[model samples]
Target: MRIYELGDGTPEVSVVGAIHGDEPCGERAIERFVDEEPTVERPVKLIVANEEALDAGRRFIDEDLNRAFPGDPDADTHEGRLAHALSREIRGTTVLSLHSTQSYAEPFALVDEVDAVTRSICPHLPIEYLVETGRFSEGRLIEHAHTVEVECGLQGSEEAAANAYWILRAFLSATGVLPAPVAGDTEPPLSLRRRDADEVVVFRLLDQIPKGPAEEYRVFVDNFQRVAPGDRVAAADGEAFSADTEFYPVLLSANGYDDVFGYAADRVGTLA
Candidate 1:
């Protein structure tokens, strides 16, 4: 991990990038921030994590770093030690971990729970959807207090990089680390792009669509859409898999992962 402190005093805000090495949008965003050299009102720490995996252009060297949070420093795996180090770095701080997904092309926020902090910070992001992990957040980075994760956009896309950069700037501005725009500024600062209304759709993760013993699989329903009973969600080995209960697909993807098709979620309610 590479740490860049962009002001004096103890850092109260942190932005972590490249938790998954294959997702480089966050890293690109961080690099752009560094290049701009924006003056911050408060101290902030920018971390480029999983450098080894990033160098190799793989997800990770041994394990998924995002899944190995609060890890052991004495562990054998590289990610375990890195996770431990990262946990220490962002202890007691408001953290924003950046990520990209194959299932969604638009940015969205993810949190362990919808608390005061989440409610405040999520609206500052350029996202209309907020997914509360519930039990599914067990080992994620967002499991930690005051930490929020975001899927910026589709992995490796230019749009994803732009989204990540804008979101990071917005997060900093919202958190008061970066100053808001002044009068007569030609372009609108990131803070201005934040959703004015408090209406945000919240989705609670229900279950995962586990991949069974099959040669191939395909997903039909669009993500974030309601999947009614008997609606065909996916297919494996030419056999169709329909929803048995009313649910919404969040990360529904055909070949996104090997162990599961994606996730089934329920629209809990809107957050204001």
Candidate 2:
């Protein structure tokens, strides 16, 4: 149970990092901010979720921490108990939950539909991949606090770290934690959805990945971009598989019982 809190004016914001221990890249990034001790006009709390797992250097010791939010106090697992405590900590605060994707894509922000909070939020996140995150399971911290989960992009890359850096800066400025806004509201050329529906489909659970290091075969050329049937989307066992001859197949995102990362198949021109 490690909690990092800085800034001492009024408690208006809280940022959560790494519900999944293996996804600790965000934890490292946020800790950098906390250690720097940025002066603030308000109070901000940085919570290191699943500290036990963090210490062990794993994603989660018991269960998927993200799914366990708004937890039951009587949870039997350590992760679930932490989720319960965290839910109580983040009530009514603007939250920036950090994440990393296996996708080679640079970085993106997953937000809900356009609305007051989202409008104010979009401008702050420099990464441009904004997609609807649905209402999501009730009582998750982000849902509880109008929070947006930021995907820092491919784990273990300097580029990904840089993405987190710039976005976090924009966030700090927008919240008036830092000096000023780096840029005014910039509407991304594409809407929250991908530019092409046939390009890619986003999914969780990676049962379809080839297996072992064979998982390396799965590659994404674009960030949830679309493709057509017979197009090379992602690789299974590092081998490109042609898309199925259906519109739905063009938007193929496959997950089975093997991987946590679901996939996309290249559907070439089917949507066209």
- Give the top-scoring candidate (lDDT): 1
Worst 10 residues of 2 by lDDT: 263-272
Model 1: CA > 4 A from native = 181-198
Would you list the C-alpha lDDT of every candidate in the order shown? 0.88, 0.58
How close is each model in CA RMSD to the real structure? 2.3, 6.9
Report the lDDT tens digits of candidate 2 across residue range 1-272. 66777776555677777776767766777777777777776677777777788778777788778777777889998878888888878776777777776654445555443346655665545553454445443445555647777777665565555566556656666666666743575423332334453332232211232323353545443444554557765676666655464222211233322443343332222111
Candidate 1, residue 55: how far the Cα is off, in Å = 0.6
- lDDT score at residue 157, model 1, on the 0-100 scale: 93
Candidate 1 lands at a TM-score of 0.94
